[model samples]
Target: MATDLRVSLTDRCNLRCTYCMPEAGLQWLAKPDLLTDDEVVRLVRIAVTQLGVTEVRFTGGEPLLRPGLPGVLERCAALRPRPRISLTTNGIGLHRTAKTLRTAGLDRVNVSLDTLRPEVFRTLTRRDRHRDVLEGLAAAHAAGLTPVKVNTVLMPGLNADEAPELLAWALDLGYQLRFIEQMPLDAQHGWRREELVTAEDILRRLGERFTLTPEGSARRGSAPAERWLVDGGPGTVGVIASVTRPFCRACDRTRLTADGQVRNCLFAREETDLRTALRSGEPDEALADLWRAAMWGKKASPDLDAPAFVQPDRPMSAIGG
Candidate 1:
């Protein structure tokens, strides 16, 4: 059963990350097409009350961009057997809203920070908001958002060499760092396996700097990240090797786009339009049935290595990475 749900609060982003969306002048979804705060809350309620969802992760081009975010968090927190709420953001505007979000019952956050170097940050994200991200991290920590995770996408000949530096930086700030293998979700759809930095390479490089050991089975469950103990100590690091080591078998999460489409997998080419049903006056149980049936029919695993593997029509931004 799908126990986790990722909801894309919005499809608009401030930064144009190279790995995601590099070009400008991209057309965004119409405001009216996006789900309202009530619609999102209703969906979460159905998932929690009917579908056995225990975790709800809010994602977006940047989730913080949604003005009604805190209210949405509040509504989700009110659900019976209240689901654990988390968010994934770029950290650009987090500095101003982290505390508010936390107060609104947000449990944790995962911020995308590829590099510490300002020049490289600008080059990778097409924006010079490195300072903002740093400030956001500090603010999140200060707000008592424990286990603030930093997600770094590994790219060959780019930020790959900064693994040690990035780990140290995160460790210094008492934050967990996770390196993710680049997937085929780029807006440009130019993903190539040759350009990816595998988890094996990441472990080799980080192992040289720190004494690392694989995490126990307790910590290595359905999570995509293969966790490791840093120096056999308190802190940990993880690698979501989606390309090198796909974890589709244990995948228990489904995604709902801001435009109200239900996706069973990140790389899924097919999507069920829930907005039509919801707008057509479908009852809550019926909506939940749609979700359950959709997930039940999900592929056993995404064929990322297939010769005919085609990128999804929607990019990472629109798909709620």
Candidate 2:
């Protein structure tokens, strides 16, 4: 299995970051409405065994919100061939959980950090504890999750000006940094086309300070970021241009929502209700075949790169970042 599986631990978050939770507060998915631990494990197994999945990423409103997240990661590690297990989070509660999570066999983590300015971070994430997130990054590093990746969403007039400094800081802190384009995933969250920081513009700006060596063309399979390393900077930097330079043609991954719906594409409006199918007694084989169907339906090119395609209704955060 070479595909990647994203398992949303919960639709709960501690920080209502502007780009993610726009309503000032989030409505949590009901306990019964969200997938159980067993359900997630079964779906992951099927994804690996049937879909030839090679990597599994745990995400969420904040993955650490899920009770016993480390245990879930351990179970995923126990899978045969041992798919590369990682997690993506906002780094709010990770300071205390990093050590245990790493010992449980979680291989990597991507912490979301947008601005270096404390006041700006507060405005961008709607929180004032920017220092806490920095401390969390320090703890994550201390926990020995080598090369922890940092995710930065660039929205012009917001955190866009902080890119160079953020990259420099991440390099100094020994973390991989990724700048993601602002997709029209949500409006109240401040996603607008004019406000977007395109990949070309970002690269040009960064190129002024550092030389980016081509990591060569991305090989098909499970990489979302088009990887790059600074010529002399500390760690690596990657760019995920879902809107500007969509790599949809090479997108081999699919998402399983917190509600147990499997979406063939992040830009998909409709999803197959796997929870209902599972409740109806669909065999594991059928469930696996359903995944195959989802992959087969993947667009040859991403909507951002295509002339026209179905625009998804849900926001990116709702799809597990």
Candidate 3:
């Protein structure tokens, strides 16, 4: 059973990253369709108490954008056999809420910082908030969110050349750096396989400036990122090569969208609705059984290289990853 659950707080985002969505932005989810704070906390309580979920990661178009985020974290923290809670955010307003979130029981964070150069950052995210991200990162660290992980996606013509520089910056600051291959999850559906910066390409480029020794599969386990010891020391870097190298067989994650739908896989087309049952006054056991059936029917790991493969209808933002 999947003990790690990724729950999307909202599909709304503050940034317009070129790789994520267009400058015009996506059609935001209606508030009425979204799970209320009480509903969210109740589902989480069931997942921890009735189900065997051990880790809970709050995601979003950007999780920090959710106004009731801190309260949700507080409730999850109060679970009997408390689940380890984390958030994945764009680091936009983190500087303002990092301390409050920490106090509300957030364990740590995985922030997106694709580039260090302000000009490049603006060009990529279509936002002039690079300094804000830096400040947010500092605030997160100051608030005791240790092992601050930085997620970077290298686009072909955009920030791909900055891989080594990005890793060096992370090493200097003791941040765990991860380079992700751009996937077919963009809202525009214009993602071309040939345009992606492959994992092998990232390794080759980084190899020019650093010596990276593979930490091996035994240590990697089910985590998407394949880690490497940077310069043969404690500081390390990781590559989430989801396209060329899929680790779905070892995947132990379950996803819940903001609207209370369960997605067995990140690329799955099918969604099982939990909100309706909850709204209809279904018992907690019924909801748990519905969740179990969804997982039990999870499709096989997607073979991106296959000709039959089709990109998921929903973008990454909507899917909670």
lDDT by residue (tens digit), candidate 1, 68-137: 9999999899889999999999998889998999999999999999998999998898888999999999
Tens-digit lDDT track of model 3 for 40-83: 99999888998899999999998898889999999999998999
How many collisions per candidate? 0, 3, 0
Q: Model 1: which residue pairs collide?
A: none
Residue 186, model 1: Cα distance from true site in angstroms: 0.6
lDDT of 2 by residue, 16-117 (tens): 677666755445667888888888888898888768888899987788878878777888889997899888988887788889999999888899888888
Report, for every candidate in turn, its global Cα lDDT versus the true structure. 0.91, 0.78, 0.93
Name the weakest run of 10 consecutive residues (lDDT summed) in model 2: 302-311
Provide the lDDT at 176 for model 3: 92
For residue 288, what is the lDDT in candidate 2? 83
Q: Is candidate 2 or candidate 3 better by TM-score?
A: 3
Itemize residue pairs with steric clashes in candidate 2. 1-52, 1-53, 2-52
Best-fitting candidate, scored by lDDT: 3
Worst 10 residues of 1 by lDDT: 299-308
TM-score of each: 0.98, 0.92, 0.99
